[model samples]
Target: MRRVTAIVPALLAALMLVVVPAVNARADLLGGKMTLRDENKMGHDFDQILRAQQNMVGDTYITDYVAEVVARVVTGKRPMPFHVKSAVIANPLINAFAIPGGYIYIFTGLIQSVDTESQLAGVIAHELAHVSQRHVVSRIEKQKKVTLLSTAGMLAGLLLGIAAGGGNAAQAGQALVIGSQGAATAAMLHYSQDDEREADHVGLNSLVAAGYNPEGMPQTFEIMLKNKWYDNSSSMPSYLSTHPGTAERITYLNDRIARMPKEFLERKDDNTRLKRVQALIRSRMSPANTALAYWDDMKQSDYTPMDWVGRGITLERLKRLDEAQTAFEKALSLAKDDPLVVREAGIFYFKSGQADRALGLLQKASIMNKDDAMALFYLARLQAEAKQYGEAARNMRKVNELVPEDWEVHHHLGMILGESGDVFGGNLHLAYAAVYSMRLDKAREYLKRANELAQTQEQKDQVRELEDAIQARAQIGK
Candidate 1:
C-alpha cells in the first residue's frame, strides 16, 4: 500500500528491522558497557530494523504534531546522549517505545486511545525521561553476567506474543530480537521498580514543565491498566506486563497530581488538532464500513468539521459517493479553511471527475499547507491530466522533496519527468522507485537504462548513488 501520508498509507516493506535485528549486527556488538558512539550505531542499525519491519504512518501532519510534543518535553532539559527523533507505527495496540538512540515510536493505537493531547504528552514525557536517565544503558551494564533475557528481548517477547522468559534469553528465537516488542520496550526498556518509579517522577516533572496538566499522567496510566484486561489480543500483555506496579504507579501519580497547584492540574487542552488527526487515523486506517459506522454513531453535538471529513472519507471508501460528497460539502460549509478538510474534499472531487473544482481547491490547499505531500501529489497528477506537464513536473518535484523515500511518489514523479521529456531524470527516479519498492531486478534494469541515458556529470552521479543503494539493499539478511 502507498504510505498513508495525509490520506495515503505507505508500507515501509520491512524497513522494520527494529525488532528482530540482523544476526551479524548482533554478533558485532561487544558484551560490555557501551560508549556513546556504540550506542549511536546500535540505535541507527535498530532504527532501520524498526522502520523496515513495521508499517509506519508517514503523514506529516500527525507525525510532526507528535514530534513537536516530544520536542516540547525534551527541549531545555538535560543534554541527552543522542538527538531525539520520533516515528509513528501503524499498529492499533496503544503502545510506544524508545530505543537507545532517542528514537521514539508512537503507535496509532495509543493516539486513538488518548482522550486529550495532555494524556499523549504525559505518556511521551515518561519515555523521554528514560532516555534522559540512560536507564537502558545502566541496566545492561549492571547485568552483563546474568543469564536473563536482554531488555530488548523481553520487550520483543511482550510485543511479538513471545513468552517473557525472565532468565531464558535462549527463547529469543532470532539473533536480532527486536520487531513486535514496541510496547514492552516502552515500559521504557523493561525497567526495574526503581527505574519505572524514576521515569514516572522525571516524566511528570517534564510533562508539567511542557505546560500540560499533571493529571494526564495518571489518567494515561489508568487507561493502560484497564486496557490490559479489555484487549484480548495476545500481543498486548507484553505491553502491560512490563510495567509491573501499575496500581502503585497510578496511586503515586494521582497523589503527586493531588499535591500539584490547582492551575497546573486544571489546565485545558484544545484538542482541535488532536481531534482532526484522530479523525484522519480513524477514517483512513480503519475498515471502511467500520469507520463509517463510527462517524455515523457520533451525536450531532459532538461533530466537528473534521468529524464530517472523517465521515466523508469513510463513506467514499465504501463507494457511497453521493453521501460522501454531501458530507464533504457539509465539512467545507463548516470550516472551509481547514487544510485537511479542503485537501481530502479536493481529492474526492478529483476522483469524482470534478476536475475544475479539484484543481482550484488542491492548488489552494497545497499553498495553505505546503508540507502536505499528498496534496502536492494529487495536484501534480491533476495538472498532468490537463496536459500541463510543466506544472505537473514542478508540483511533483515538491511532492518528491516532501516524501523523498515514498516509492509511489517517486514512481509518479518519474512518470511526470518522462512526460516532461527529462529522460535521464525520469529514468533515475524510476531506478529510485524500484530501489525503494524493493524490486531489485527492475532497479538494476532502470539503473542500466539511466546510466546509458546520462548526458551530464550530475546525471551520472545520481545513477551511482542509486546503484550504491541497490547494492546495499540487495544484501541478504540485512
Candidate 2:
C-alpha cells in the first residue's frame, strides 16, 4: 500500500514527514474521498514501515500517558471518522507529527520541552484538527498529478532521516524537489497558510472544550519559537525550517485568548502527570550530560519529587554513585509513596547491589503502578536472582505481555521461564528476543530449539505463530 501524508504542528513550523510509503502500489485517489477502511489499511502499512525503521517507545507507562491525553482532546471535538491513537517516539527532536487514519506521534524531546500538560495537549489538538479537517487529503487531491515516486521518495527520505536511515533518501528527495516537481510536492505535503489558520481556530476551541487553558495553544508555539530548533535547519527538514507566519499566528492566538472569560483563562492545568512523565523521559531516555545539566539548572526550590529522581538518574549515568544516592534519598524523603520515585530509586539500588533494600521498594512500586512494565521487570528480576523462579517467571511474563517487542524483556522472561521448567516457553521467548534484537541467525536457532521441545499441539501452534512473525519482521527490513 502506497499512500502516506505529512504530519505536524503547523503552529510550530511547516508540516514534517511522518510517513512516506515505500511500496509500489498507486495512491488511493479512489474517486470521491478516501474511505475510512482505505486510510486504516494505509496507516497500518505506514506503521509497519516506521517500525521496520525506528524504535517507537515500547514503554507502556509513557505511551499510555500520551494516549490518555489524546483521548481527552478527542472528547471535546466533533465526532471523528477515525480513531485517534498516540505513539510516543524515542526521538530527541522537539516535534510531533500525525499520519493518516489518526496516528499521532510526539518526540521525547517535545515532552521534555513543554512546561505543562496543556501545552502538549494544545499541539495535539492542532494536529487533530488537521486530521478532522482533512487538510492533507484535500491538498493531495489538488496535487495528485505530481510524480508519485519523487514525492514518496522525498517524504520517505525526509522522515527517514529523523527516524534512523542516513539522509540518502532525503538528499535524493531534495534533489528531486530542486527539479520541476518541487512546487507541486511542497504544496501537496504542507498545509496552506489558510489551512494552518483554520486548524488554529478549530484546535483552540477543542483545547478549551477539553477543559484546558486557551493560552496553552499559543504558549506552546512561543516555546517552539524560542527553541533553537527554529534556527537549526539540519535539526529538522528544510520545509519545516521556515516558519514565517509564526509571530503573526501567535499574535492572533493571544488576541483571542484575551477575549475569553477571566476565570476561564485562569483555569490551571494539572502538571502533576506531565511532570512525572517528563521526569521519567529525561532521566531514562535523554543524553546523560544534557539531562544532568537540565536538572542541575533548575532551582532547588522548583525541583519536584520526580525532578530529584531525574537528577539521581543522570548522576548515576555519569557514575556519580554517591551523589546519585543522595539525590534518590532526598526524593524518597519528599515523596516516599510515589510510584515513579519508588520504582526508579529501587532500580538504582538494585543495580548498586543493595538488592535487599531494593526488593521491598520495587515490590511496593509494582503493586502501586501495576501498569508500569519497568517496575514489574525489576521486581521480576529481583525475584529471579533470589531463586524465586515461580514468582519471577509469573512477573516477567506480565512484563513481556506489556512490552512484547522489547528484546531485553523477552530475553529475561525467557531465562526466567527456563528456570521455572518451561523449556518450550523459554525457547519461544528467546527466539522472540533474538528477532526483536535483529539477531536473525540466533532467532532461527532458538526457533528450531523451541519446535523440538514443543510436545503439545498448543506449543507447536505457538512456535508456528512466532515463525510467521519473524518472517513478517524480516520482510519489513527488506
List where candidate 2 sits over 4 angstroms from the true fold: 1-32, 141-187, 229-244, 298-302, 419-421, 434-448, 471-478
Error of 2 at 272 (Å): 1.6
* Overall lDDT per candidate, in order of appearance: 0.71, 0.73
The per-prediction tally of clashing pairs is 28, 0
- For model 1, the stretches where C-alpha displacement exceeds 4 angstroms are 1-32, 139-189, 234-238, 437-442, 471-478
Model 2 has a clash total of 0
Per-candidate Cα RMSD to the true structure, in Å, reads: 6.0, 5.3
Measured by lDDT, the strongest candidate is 2
What digit string (tens of lDDT, one per residue) describes model 1 on residues 204-323?
Answer: 998888788888888888888777777455124234544558789889999888888889977999888888889988888776777877877889578888888899888888899999
Report the lDDT of model 1 for residue 310.
90
Quantify how close model 1 is to the true structure by its C-alpha RMSD in Å.
6.0
Query: What lDDT is obtained when candidate 1 is compared to the true structure?
Result: 0.71
